[model samples]
Target: MSAESLERQTRSYLSNNVPQIQEHGGFFEIQDVDDESGEVTVAIGGACSGCGIAPMTMNAIKHRLPDDLDDVSKVNVTRAGGPRAAVMPTKTEEMEEMEEYKDYSPPF
Candidate 1:
């Protein structure tokens, strides 16, 4: 139950278990596993980066990681660049949409 082993086990289990992840070219890397705090930090990248249902993916990973693992107390699936990209439709986006409508006219 050493930290290194736990980290390896987590990485291996996730890659082998989630068929959907594999099919979509998504993979999880164990960034860090703290034996003292039982925190497993994972970096989920590739197709999962821009996936619409990434939250669900993370949740599934969280729930599944601890089911059979004795040392995992917290499963943190970190989506690369998620925070910056998850913002609501920006003003620039709204302006772009408005531009498209500028050239539009009614048949009447």
Candidate 2:
């Protein structure tokens, strides 16, 4: 199947299987689809914008999304901007970086 066709099918499948993705205030956006690799990169939104569980959602998409769609090999998700956003990709590179574990110790 064509790349566009495969992507459309993947999205439709996701919507149907995970309607909660939208109803629960989560939405998925298709960032890009590579025809050669059959990989689909997506972005999360709404309640999933910065949710801690977003990673699980990504795993879910990776495993579940391709089951119902053909030619879809993998699913990738990137958070827009929130608590779960990546440390470097959001334009915060110039800011002083702290090692989370540097001063971390048992308070007990």
Candidate 3:
């Protein structure tokens, strides 16, 4: 198959066959399609960007992509940002907890 066809097929299959991805708001933009190596480089964005379970999503896509079609040797999912945002406790509760643990420290 031609690289252009493979790229289009990749997008179509992901949008259709992967219902879980669709439901989870998985947004994938095709960065580039390599015909020589049959590799699809996708940028993972939106909810999947900040999600903790994004690795699972990428894995699912990786394993499933080949199953859905041929010529796709690999799926490369990468994050543009540094990392997912950390979940922090409320300010007041966090302050109280900090005060409680203020004196507690690991002795080197």
Number of the top-ranking candidate, with lDDT as the measure: 1
Each prediction's TM-score versus the true structure: 0.68, 0.65, 0.64
Error of 1 at 34 (Å): 0.1
Write one digit per residue (lDDT tens) for candidate 1, span 84-105. Answer: 3333224533432454444433
lDDT of 2 by residue, 1-108 (tens): 677887788778777776766876677777788888889887777676544445555556666666756688887766555553333323222111334322332211
Worst lDDT 10-window in candidate 1: 99-108
Model 1, which residues run further than 4 Å from truth?
81-108
Better of 1 and 2 by lDDT: 1
lDDT of 2 at 33: 89
The 10-residue segment of model 2 with minimum total lDDT is: 89-98
True-vs-predicted CA distance for residue 17, candidate 2, Å: 0.9
Best by TM-score: 1
User: Candidate 1: global Cα-lDDT?
Assistant: 0.67
- CA lDDT of every candidate: 0.67, 0.63, 0.63
